[model samples]
Target: MIAEIIPQSSALTKKYTNFYITNLLILKNMGQVLGMISAVLILSAIYFRVGGQKNFSNGLFIVGIIGEILFIAIMIMAIFD
Candidate 1:
C-alpha cells in the first residue's frame, strides 16, 4: 500500500507540474503577442495622428493602451507563476 501511494503521488505531482508549466508558457507567449500588437497599434495611431485622422488615431490609441495594460498584467502573472 505504501509503495503504491508513493508512486501515485509522485505521478500526480508531475502531472500538475507539467500542466502548470504549460499554462505559464502559454501565458508568456500571449503576453508577448499582446505587447507586439500594442506597439503596432500605438505606432499606427501616431502615424494616423500625424496624417490628420484624429478620430481613428484616438480609437487606436485607446485600444493600444488597453492592450498594453493587459500585456503587463499577463507578464506579471507569468513572472510570479
Candidate 2:
C-alpha cells in the first residue's frame, strides 16, 4: 500500500504589518530620516527665497533648487523603469 503524505499547513502566518511597525516607539532607519531632513531643508530654502530675502545664501539656495530638480527627474525615471 502506498502511503499519502499530506503536509501540515503553517500555524505561524505573517501579520499585515511588521511587529515593530505595529508597536509604538519604533525606530526609523537612517535612510528614511535623512531623506525627510533633506526634503525639509530643500523646501525651507525655496520658501525663504520666495518670501523675498536677498543674500549670498540666496545664490546657494538657487543651486540647491536646480540640484533638486535633476534629482527628482532621475528618481522618476528609475522608479518608472
Compare the candidates by TM-score and give the number of the best one.
1
TM-score, cand. 1 vs. native: 0.87
lDDT of 1 by residue, 1-81 (tens): 223334435777668666767888898999999999999999999999999999999999999999999999999988865
Candidate 1: worst-modelled 10 consecutive residues by lDDT: 1-10
Candidate topping lDDT: 1
Candidate 1 collision pairs: none
lDDT string, candidate 2, 1-81, tens digits: 001232234333233223423332122233344445556667777777777765644765666666556556545543442
Candidate 1, lDDT over the whole model: 0.88
Q: Model 2: how far is 35 from its true place, Å?
A: 7.7
**Structural similarity to truth (TM-score) of each candidate:** 0.87, 0.36
- Where is model 2 more than 4 Å wrong at Cα? 1-53
